[model samples]
Target chain A: MIKLTYRDAVRRALADALRADENVIFFGEDVAEAGGVFKVTPGLYEEFGGERVMDTPISEEAFIGAALGAAITGMRPVAELMFADFVPVAMDQIANQIAKYRYMSGGQFIVPLTIRAAQGAGAGFGTQHSQCVESWLLNIPGIKIVVPGTVKDMYGLLRTAIDDNNPVIVLEHKVLYNYAEEIDEAELTHVPLGKAAVRRVGKDITVVATQLMMHRSLDAAERLAGEGIDCEVIDLRTMIPLDEETILESIAKTGRLVIVEEAPHAGGWGADIAALAADKGIYWLDAPVKRVNMGGALIAYSPPLEDEVVPNVSRIADAIRAVMRA
Target chain B: MTQNGIALPAQMRQDMLKKMLEIRAAEERIQGLFLENLVRGTTHLCIGQEACSVGVAAVLQPGDTMTCTYRGHGHALAMGMTMKALMAEMMGKASGACKGKGGSMHMTDASIGLLGANAIVGAQLPIAVGAALTSRLKKTGNITVTFFGEGAANIGAFHESLNLAAIWKLPVLFICENNLYGEYSVWSKTTPVRDIAVRASSYGIPGIVVDGQDAECVYHEVSAMAERARRGEGPALIELKTYRFRGHSRTDQAPYRPKGELEEWLKRDPILILKERMIADGQLDETEFEELRESIDRQVVEVVEWAKTEPYPPVEALYEDIYYEG
Candidate 1:
């Protein structure tokens, strides 16, 4: 076992993939010599040289679309979008081209592509740079969505995503770059997508979260445990092809649910989870499912205002209490 | 007929004429089927842009790939997609090129390296660049060509893709079929420059303008650009001056075009000009040209009848092909 930061784990995973397969190439703005804005891809350019780790012009649509084209031809490309907030600029390529090519081509093509982007709003990067837009990609078919909260998951999910035969979006929270944890070397080798990890087990309310919210919820759960209120937390590793069975089973046991997310409450991934419980596990629920999320407003630049707009540990704890009380 | 001051072989010249006629005949047949309500959804026909499709396709090797816009019937035919599959696809049949899922606008055949025919304007630019990146990374010596309209040249994707292609030295050719109209708006209203190829100078890559109605001219220009790309000289942009003889979609009457403009363009029809040049040069007789047209017309008619009898995809097909199950 060894310790590693989330950023280092990601860099190691990318370097490993590049070494394992010559077809795997990394391309994005400032990824080569600059080593990425977040430093997640540090030393890749020096290690693999420019051809394998390329620095592209600040053209998200072009690079993203080019990554899709490269995937269809014969290479596994990992494209970094810098920030998830800027994904809308390349929505046509993501939603229409990358997501539809396989089905549209009648199984003739496979897009072994991974798009890595920093999401969530705690760093005071303002509206454009700080936002969790994973919901925008949830409805898109043919693309898998992965949000890794731990160092082990960051390494394993990235490796798995690189090896997968479809387009996968890896949403790394901006704040998690410095977050470090102990890792089992074997666990870091492979963490299959589409599986939920049970962080805590309890008989009270069930709290489901992703990305940054997962860590916040775990913190909230620990506090609640001291208050004689036990909360079971599940980190939803992948949003698409969601681990519904795990969530439903947890709901069946707890009979109450609290969904925490960084995106706006309306049309967020929380709604999808709430709907799933409402539709199939209605009889299992003792109370209406509660969703804790950011309100519908542009993320402000001020530190306090940004903090107020995004979900926090207290907000998740409050939602868990409300659902349990109901 | 001469191409680039060199006489093209009789067989090559004859094949070009045959391909152009096939596209024209198929498009005309599709118009009739659309009027009869046989084809579901909408189709953007390439009735008058046959030269641009055939000219560029004529230079592509077996491994070379190409992508196009919604008006891609001519491009698909030029790339050697079977009439039976394309016709079935327009009719939404199980035996279609995309198993009836892509319909007319998204026609694709990966076997022949027809990546896809995107409906979104300028979406295929980066995709083609990506293919080129793959070719360069793997040292495959293959090239990719993407076709779009004048309006797409003004899009952010076009500029970004061209810039990246030049900086990375990717093997791609960007072909702009400047047909003077974008949906209902004239080119002058939307574009700032008279020649879209001049925009390529900003990227430090070679750019040229050609007579789109002259198949020989388009062939010569694209062949040179493609050769440069394959030799690792980076990307180039070619703008073909042409006109669309039909409406943008099935419902459009094209009332926005200037009076007498259609008649003038019709006089310089690409198919007619090629046929006349071949006859005048004694490479083909007038009777032989007529027979060639008749043969293509007969093939298109048979394919339409065959498509009518084919079945729609099964209900299970809807859930399949979204991801690579393996």
Candidate 2:
């Protein structure tokens, strides 16, 4: 067991993957010598050498597309997008090419491609650099998405993503990069995707969240535990192959649900969760599901303005309380 | 080596000639099927650009992989995909290359080394670069060829992919088939440079231009570059000055073309150029050319008939191919 930050754990997972397989390679802007824009992949270049670890030009479409092509040709490439906000610039390659390559190729290609990007609000990177855009890819099939909130999930899910025979995008929240925890190093290897982690178990209300919201939801659960309202917090580890079973089971136990997300309510993944609870888990619900999402605005440069839109601990707790009252 | 290209054995020349004819036949037949409402959705055809496809594929061996735009039936056929698979894919039959899922814009047959074709402009450039990255990392001694148009050179992916391939010295050939028009707009209007290959200097790599109508010229340049890349000499951008015979897609008459442009281009039709050269070299006769065309046309028609009997993929198939279960 060792104490490590979320960033260090992610770097550890990458080192493990490189050590485990010669086919595993890494590349992105400043990923080689500079570690990464977030300094999450430092020392990998020196450890693995330039052939396996490279620094690509700031061309998301090229590197992302290269990841797909390289995966098809049998090399596992871990590409970094720098910031999730930059995804739009290469949306064509990410959405059309990487996401559809396997299906379009008649299941003939095995794409063991992993793309990691720094996501969510922190460091005052503003709208173009701080948005949590994982929802932008939910509609695009043939992609597996994982957003890890803790050091454990970061290491576990990333190891799994590198080994999985598909394209997986690991959205690492910028705010959580420095989040520290003591974890058993051996236990964090190859955590299965499509499964949710029950962060805190309770019977009053279920709080479903992921990434930055996952941490806030856990905070809400702990704070609410003092008030007699017990919240069951479920951290959705994988986004695309959603762990609906866990959400449903938790909802069945609690009979009340509050969904927290960094994206706006409009066209967000939370809507899908709400619809899922309504359609499949309605019988268990004692109250309508309350969604705590970005307050219908873009993430601004100012921290206060950004806070108004980003779902936080207080907002999550409020939603849980409102659901409990109902 | 001849003035036109590397002098090849009789078998190789015959194969190139036949493949070019088959690509032309297939493109023409697809248009007819579209008019008859047989091929659903839409399709982009590479009719007059058979030489460009044939020339590139002719030099590549079985281990070499390729990716191209939606107008890649020519590339597919040249890469050894059967007429039945190509035509059946557009028809969305169960026997289609993508099992009737990808429809017309995406066609992939990996067994023949074709990664797939993408519908979006400039999306496949980075994918081929990825494949090249694989070759470099794995020391596979194989190359990847990606075909795009003049318009793609202007997109960020093109420059990004070129720079990515350049710095790493990845074994990739960026084949830009400059067909004058990127949809409705002329190349000159969209691109500042007269020669797309000249832009390769920005990445400090060699860029060569070839007369796309002459299959031998494209073959010569691609083969040379492929060899150079296989020798670990890094990537190169090759521009083939070609033209498409038809409008982009769906009922487009290409009224955007200037006066006499079509007629002038028609005189240099890739198939005609190859046919004239083959005849002058006494490698082919009028009867052989006629017989080959008739045979290819027959195969094209036969595939449509075969597809008529083939059903669409079962409804359950929709749930499949979306993810790799393992």
Candidate 3:
């Protein structure tokens, strides 16, 4: 068993990919010598050299588009956008071009591209810097959305993303990078896209969480367990081809559902999943599916204001209790 | 190589003029069809900009790649994409290059190395740079050309793609078809610079401005640049000074263009200059020119009729091309 931080797991995945394939390359602003602003790509430039790991100009659209073009021509390119907020500048290329190429071209072309961006609100980065914009990307079709909550999922899902013959958006929670977990190196296997993992199984209430919220959900589950409320927790590793079956099965077993998310409550992936449950798994629910999500506002710079904006373990616990009571 | 103008062979000159006239006449026909509502959807006619496409395309090898913007019918046609395919694409028929899914803005024919056309301004620049990079990496000896307008020169993509091309010495020709307008707006009102070509010098590469109304002048410069690219000498920035005679799309007469400027540019009509010069040089007589026009007209009519007879894409095609075979 190897103990690694979420960031280390990601670094390991990238290292493995670079070592395994010569065509795999990476480029982004301050990604080379700086080893990525978040240190997710640390030591890669030294091992692979500039030809494989390059520092690009501050042009998100171009570098991302370059990644797409490279991927189409048999290179597995991992493009790092400094922040998730900057992804909007390259949305047309990602959403309109990368996502639609395989389908639009009738399978004549394949975009084996992976776009990695640091997401979530932490470190007091103001409104612009602090945003959980994974929901926006989730709305786009034809691309897989991978949101890794743990070091294990980070290592596994990223490897799977690089290998997938489709465009994949890997949204890393900024807050979870330093979070450590002991994982078996051999067992730290690549998880298939669209599959969810049952983090903590229970029968009282089902808690669906992703990214940072998954940790919070687990904490809430422990707190609820002390209060004699056995809450089932499911980590939605991939959001797009969401493991609806796992979520609905948990809901069916528990007969209660509480969805937790760090992004704003309105129009988040939680709502999409809740709608799916409402429309398809209505008979399986014991009560109305409760959604414990961040308040509708931008994540503020001040610690207090930021704390007020995002959902916490207490809120999730309260939501699960409310759903259990109902 | 100097930025000074180069001489053109008589044969090459005649061919350039003929290509320019073909694009000019075809664009005029497209405009007529659009105005009569026969060509459904929006059409970005490159009427006065024939010299740009003809000039750049004249330099390309059969296997070289090219990418363009929404105003790409001229590029596609000049690169030998059949008028039938383009017209069928405009008419939303299965015979279209992308089988009617791409429409006008997303035309693609990878068989001829026409990678694709993007509607987003400056988007294709990076893709072209990447394509050139791939060619160099694989030692394919094939170059890539991307066409954009003067407005795109100021975009972050233009700077990034150009810098990458220059730094890597990639065989990329950044063809700026400076048509004075981006959509219904004029670049003079938006851009601070008088000439977009001047910006290329900042990237440590040669930037040249050619008379976009004279096809032979534009062609000679592009041919030299293409030759330079084949020798791995590096990328070039060629700005073709031209004007858009039609509206940005099918509708909306451009109210932004000044009356005197429009009339002055119209006086330098590329088709007329080519026709007159060809007759004056005795390379083509009036009778031969008239016969050629009739032949082209007949070809256009036949293509449109053939396209009309083709069936629309099946409904199942919607789910067909979204991913490659696993």
Candidate 4:
């Protein structure tokens, strides 16, 4: 096993995809020269040359639409959106054109395109830069949404996303890119798009989290263990075709549940999980579902305000404790 | 004007006149179908714009692709989307080209190389460029043509696509169908430039303006640009000054266009001009032209009847086309 950061794992997956398929190409703003803003595409341009690893002009619409057009004509393009908040500008192409093509065409076309976007709040970036807007994307029917919380998960999931025949939105949490973990190097590890994984097993309460929040939940679980509170942590790697069975199975075991997410509370990923549990597994619950989420408004610029707005380990632990008490 | 009695080939002149008549008669029926609520969704009829479609499409070979705008019915038909399939698409029938899902705005028939008709203004520009890029990479010797309006000419996508096409010497022909308006709004009021094609010079390419009301003139220009593209001599921007006889969609009152302007364009009605020219130039007599029109009318009626008898798609079809899975 080779130790790799989440960012390096993504790079390896991209490199592997590029090497595996002659048709796979990477294009984005600063992706070629700067090696991506997060260094996820580091040294790729040098290895692949300019034709395959294209450094496009700062035209999101052009690059995004280019990827879609390329996909239909036999090239599998992995496009980076720089940040998740910027996806709205290219939403028309994504929502109307890319997502609906195969269904609208009655299976005539396969939009085998993958868009990787960096999301979530960290590094003190203000409202325009920092956002966790995966829910808006989750509403789209045809596209798959994948969120990888760890290095290994990121590697396996990204490889699967690249090989997917449908349009896949691989949303990487900005805060978790540098987080290191053991990863297999020899070949592509396939991580299923809609499955959840258990990060830690405990009996008292099931804590369901996604992206960066999964790590925070795991840390909180470790801390809560000292207080004699055994918390079960489930990382929801893919959000859209959610691993409902895994979440429900853990909920059945613990009977208490707490969902943690970094996006705003009103319509976060947690709300969907909570609703699913409420509608299907309500009778099995020992306590009402509790959720820890970012504040309703945009993340404030000030450090303290930003910290207060985004959920961390302490808040997740508190939510788990509160759910246990309830 | 002096070419009225000029020695143009009998077959070529007759072909132009017939195509214009087909577009006019077909679109006239489309308007009736739309008004009677036989057609589904919003319709952007290209009623007065028959010349551009016949002219530009006449230039393209069978393998070349076209990206069209919302007001694209004429192009689709002219590029060989059958009258019945198009009418069924307009009626939201399963036999329609997009299986009735795309409705009036989005129509795609990849077999005939009609990529799609995008409703979003200026969005198809870059997609066409990408198609051209694909052709160049594959060494297919096929050109990609994009049909947009004067309003789209002012958008960022237009500039980006044109510049990229020129820079790469890609096989792309930009057909700017300057109908003087976008939807219910006038383009001149929205843009600073008097001539939309003038911007093409900035991208280091030729900007040719053709009489959109003249099929032969439009055909000559498009054919020349297409030849240049196929020869790998880069791209060209051709502006076809045209007009729309109807409101933008079902809801618009068309208050933005002046009454006198409509009357002036009507005097130059493309189909009528083509017929008059054909008769005067000895292409065909009035009897032969009328006989051809009747034959086309019969063909269209047969197609619509065939579509109406076709069965609807199964419910399971909704789940089938979103992705390609082995």
Each model's fnat? 0.91, 0.86, 0.47, 0.45
lDDT string, candidate 4, A1-326, tens digits: 77788888899899989999988889888999899988789799999988789787777777788787777777788999999999997887788778876776666677888999998887788888889878888778889899999887888999999999888999998988888876456644879888999999998899998878888889999999999999899999998779999999998898999988888877777888999899888988988898888757679789988888888888888888888788
**Which candidate number has the best TM-score?**
1
lDDT of 2 at B17: 81
**TM-score for the B chain of model 4:** 0.93
| Alpha-carbon RMSD to native, per candidate | 1.6, 2.2, 2.5, 2.4
**Chain A TM-score values for every predicted structure, listed in order:** 0.98, 0.98, 0.98, 0.97
Q: What DockQ does predicted model 3 obtain? A: 0.53
TM-score of chain A of 1: 0.98
Q: Which stretches of candidate 4 lie over 4 Å from their true place?
A: A186-188, B1-12, B163-169, B251-256, B315-320
Supply the global lDDT for candidate 4.
0.83
User: Which 10-residue span in candidate 4 chain A carries the lowest summed lDDT?
Assistant: A181-190
lDDT of 3 by residue, B137-250 (tens): 777788899999888887788998898889888899999888888776788788988888888889988798888877777778888888888889999998888888877887
Worst 10 residues of 1 chain A by lDDT: A181-190
TM-score of each candidate structure, all chains considered together: 0.98, 0.95, 0.94, 0.94
Worst 10 residues of 1 chain B by lDDT: B1-10
lDDT of 3 at B174: 93
lDDT of 1 by residue, A181-276 (tens): 886777778799899999889888889998789899999999989988989999998897699999999999999999998888778999999999
Error of 1 at B198 (Å): 1.1
lDDT of 2 by residue, A213-312 (tens): 8888888888988999888889999988898999999999989998898887788998999999999999999998888887578888987887777877
Q: Which parts of model 1 have CA positions greater than 4 angstroms off? A: B1-3
Which pairs clash in model 4?
A: none
